[model samples]
Target: MNRTPEPMSRRPELPFHWTLVLLLALSVVLAACGASGAPSNAPAAEADQERPIKIALMAPLTGGAAAVGEPQLNFVRLAVEQFNAEHGTNIELVEGDTELDPAKATTLAQRLLADEAIYAVIGPAGSQEVAAVAPLLAAADLALVSPSATKPDLTEQGLPNVFRVVPRDDVQSATVAQFLLQRLAATRVWLIDDQSSYGVGLVDAIEAQLRAAGVAVVRESVGQDETDFSALVTRMRADQPDAVFLGTQVASQGALLARQMQEQRVQALLLGGDGLMTEDFIANAGGATEGAYVSFFAPDVTNLPSAQPVIEAYTSRHGAVGPFGPPAYTAAMVVLEAILRASAEGPLTRAAVRDAIAQTNQAESLLGIPIAFDTKGDIQNASFFLYQVQGGAFVPAR
Candidate 1:
């Protein structure tokens, strides 16, 4: 599946994690399957065919970030369902709720490590969660494919088993900074971090880029759980900056900030990273999100013809799609495809799946972009896009 990078114009048309319901159902099915174990003398191929191959989706399924994690979980389930139906192989999808907490993610990592049946993981959506679990999973040699975690250090640590479908923060922040300086003509920008690993890293990158361009930058930090932004809004109003960039993983917090800005009569334009590109942000912003901009690593799959089937299936069950779901689908596809490739050759082991993932080369993904991994396990030639919320929907910013 070797492919050269393609330009955007040439591309093809491109979660309630339903966590508790899925867990109970999968538990029963798994119990039944385990009860009917194959005989000791069964052939290797027979045993493999009968055995269930499991992959875990680790996301913030029950916390403030659940808005983003729910879609991620659901989309991974969609991918697993489609793969199982097409291949007639039993692949069990499991869920691990990290609740957007690093400590919780660490515990979940240990649980997954103990479950020898799970060969790979789809997420631990937040960057901090990924950081917390990456070492443990790496030590165990369990493959991890994160759809939303974009911290550059996640891949730079030489963890062979960690992979992601999105561009790194450096790439995303530079792209956003370019849009601010060129497209938005922003001269004075106020940068805010939600104090999470994702927010702090992204804000730092954007701040450096803006400062390098001779743009005036005002930097601030807020707690991840903080909801009140009155003081920040007052400061922004006084500074009268051209735009405010929020680097927060919690979508609702972004919404709250936006509403508070509007209430305080701050005229500065609002911009955010991929984490704020969710339905929760739009719906909860009380119409303040209109015209707000978000820089995302993946394109809107609703516009990609190649992604029509998956999008239709997802929307039929769930509602409209968001930025994170499509990437999660892509991540799931990468891991599942690699698992099949490994299983076809011989017994499927974590090492074999990890090696197979390294060889991934999809000519066109759901977003209609070519997918391939470099030596570091990051997607090759990964890029980002800009979307603006208009009339309550995220559309290409133009």
Candidate 2:
């Protein structure tokens, strides 16, 4: 019966060779698994997914516009602090001072990109600066969220990686023109700009909109450094436009124009963009800023319920927040959200973050506005706020 337990295998040699092959295969797998080197794409993945992800803020930390740029950077810092506290994540900020200069902005952007570590950029607060560095950012596929660059052409350039929190110059210009016609019944409007891209673009945009709305438009241009505006004011006095729209910076030239208008007895109500929403403008214009009108990209954040803490905290630390601060905070918020989202999915590369940013739809923005981006990277559902200078202070007009 136990004749010969049919040899355990028909071929004993075959069984031994098969056992050896299996053992060798297992040993190879174990050796591979035990190796200390990283898996595929580990270097890039580790660098991108490192703790304390880095972000850079590009603003004028020095120069004439430093006052505006420094506040913006602090607001960004506040946003990052709040984000880190609430989310249990660590994020570090690197400063790149653009100084409100286009050339400087390009250089700084290039330097940031060359480093291969900075994740996102907060500013380069001026329109010219944004315009200059936009191409570099687009090429590098980095996400650049600007708080206060309002040039009309910027968003139209089709750079998917660039996003601005505030409305564009074209939209603001049209809003200002419509307000002039309906609110002030401005039949004759005098348009003047500082010949810079921001000034020229805004004035032209307003003129087009005003003429289309059956309002009379007169145009003029001035250099950025032109301080003595007597000739321009004298012309204004003779022409007698119901309102004068000055597309210039507050400290640079807008205040001087307001002062000279008063001296020349030009009775037109001075209407300016957000640039004129500063104490320096009031101080420089002295009593001449009285009865003037100004429009801003965002409603005063001091009065917003969501921004109360930000305002209080910013004021406690930096004395006073500038017109650009709230927008910068919102920009930071959006950028942080994007970074977190990209991190959740996989590696936090610039392109991944940019993709996440383009999907933003902040239901309750820090500035009391719904923050969203259109295909062109312009803020959606944006509105302009009007302020009237009464008794030497800018007060909400609407």
Candidate 3:
């Protein structure tokens, strides 16, 4: 001890750097395990876990209406992607094809309703399909917003969960009537329908509007699935009306009718609804489709500054813009906004989101308009626009 106390042996200090590294590695592994949908993150495990909001999109992806429905779905998808990218929240999209059939739509609605995760549903492209599924959605307390279902009955029924972006067919028909009487100065008109709820409803409205405007209904005919339309053409030629109003979908039958009308030298101005405003109509009718007027829900994107980015992104990704592109985008935006607004106060539940949507007023959207809903969940001020086919393109009717 007196001899330099045998230099005290130094105890080894822990390599704190290595300890910190190990701790960090362990933390990372735990985080990864948690994110891997482990038991702790199971649906039932954590009641407060922020579940990704789910949206169900029902449309005709593989049927006659696919031409219209597919583009709508594509636009919705684009909007969802953009919304998620902009806001770091996950929004899951669940697609179900109804094939433009009411029965199929009902089936899809049942399936979507069973999925407790789905917060909202987008469509059942046809008006009839919407009518079929309205009760199902109401029973499930699910919110549904359609971009193309324009039947007045859906809103008139006072369904608290149902809404649409497009104006009703009745409004469209009245607009067309006004344009025909005031703008085109067409006195006598021939009306034709495909016997569908949409077609027949629009025809009735147009006829009523025309009569009110003091325009004579010269002749009326009903078309079926057949392609032959010589009979209709002959009848129109005999009536010699100033215009022909087609209350029908853009089917081969309708196209043949227009073509036959042209071939028979019937010079009546052809008019139709959004259902007939398609490139197929122009292609099938050829020169006959030129100068034809169509009444449709306006694509508000073209005029809205807020929608420009959405339109550009959509075109870049999908190649073709959706029909009612702005409205479709706005519909998705509405859903997202409702979710955000609801989540601000508490967890995101279907009922809370639906209530938020119903209570929403003057919410600015890509449509460049204040969004609000009436007591019946319908957009209070929805309106339609008139467009004419010129050089195979649909331009606003002057």
Candidate 4:
């Protein structure tokens, strides 16, 4: 029991997470066991035995971002299953839904921390949620691997525990801005974003990139629930910029902005980051999403040979995989590897696993890319790809 974290385990025979009184009774029972009753090498056997560890996946399973968060959740579960099937490690996954709100994420994170069994977390789906829970997680020594949160400042905060599989907002924003500036020849651009942390962060990066590239940038901020964008659309129509950049999610207000732009006859090309790359965006915006460009963390994953099996498994069990699915799988894989590596060295404590995760350097993963972390916890060698909504689906822009 000393092999596990102090907060969780104290009894040898029983797993972690039990009341003190119950643990005392179990201790007495173990103490009474004679040489014939309990094996002399039980302690050695226990060390070799695979101990159970719990990892939580924090995402919005109930609110607006559910369309995207649900797929991420599924992929995390699939990763757990695949890991369990292939290895002797006993890893359990817990769900901590934030409902797409940072406040909710904070509450859920507190609950997850209270459960001493959970040493690491996968996501809270959005950068706002991650921001809300980051300080709390660092205080408790819980490491996190975000699959989709792309806000640049979160990793910039110097919290060594905050790691993410996706590229930062700056990388994504610059990639999209350059694509528009050089390829589409966009000169004047209008920028709109929800007031969420993820949205505002991407907008700030994109705005800076556009101005640096000599493209005129106009900026606006809106509430996440403000669906009716007629006034905004009219304003955009008046400007008649070469393109409109929406830094928001598919389920929040980006889809609505796309629809209103089309309804108001705003002819500018619609562009966005990974948040708008979901199929729900096209479905909700209808024909308005056609020809809209999206800057995503990676190219269409379903096309990759390394992704075919994951795609098939995801499709067969939980319908089609989204842009965030493969990254979620990678996030889980990274955490599991950290746990295995830490356990190999010594007892599996939160500190040990956090250290292991910080030193991660996977040569290959299902994402078909090298995975490593810099001093800032940003995934190194990150690549962002541009995609276009063509024929109601996301395809490579070029």
Of the candidates shown, which would achieve the greatest TM-score relative to the real structure?
Answer: 2
Q: Write the per-residue lDDT of candidate 2 for residues 140-212, one digit (tens) a residue.
A: 9998999988777888888888899998877788789888988889999999887877778888889998999
In order of listing, the candidates' clash counts read: 6, 0, 0, 0
Colliding residue pairs in candidate 2: none
Residue 85, model 2, lDDT: 95
TM-score of 1: 0.73
After superposition, which runs of candidate 4 have C-alpha atoms over 4 Å from their true positions? 1-51, 63-65, 100-117, 188-201, 216-242, 248-268, 278-288
- Kindly give the stretch of ten consecutive residues in candidate 4 with the minimal lDDT sum: 14-23
**Candidate 2 worst ten-residue window by lDDT:** 15-24
- Model 2 C-alpha lDDT versus the unseen true structure: 0.82
lDDT of every model, 2 decimals: 0.87, 0.82, 0.76, 0.82
Q: Which TM-score value belongs to model 4?
A: 0.74
The TM-scores of all predictions, comma-separated, are 0.73, 0.79, 0.77, 0.74
**What is the per-residue lDDT of model 3 for residues 1-398, given as tens digits with 9 covering 90 to 100?**
46654444665655743543454465466456567866554554363464446888888888887877777777888878888888887888877789999998997787677566678888777789989998889877788888778777788887788887667777787788888888879888888888887788888888988888788896455656667778778877888899888878754555677788889999988888877776787778777788887777765355457667777777777775645556666777777777778889787788888888787775576666677888877776766777778887877776
Query: Of the candidates shown, which would achieve the greatest lDDT relative to the real structure?
Result: 1
For model 3, the superposed segments whose C-alpha errors exceed 4 Å read 1-46, 195-197, 225-240, 250-267, 298-306, 324-326, 362-370
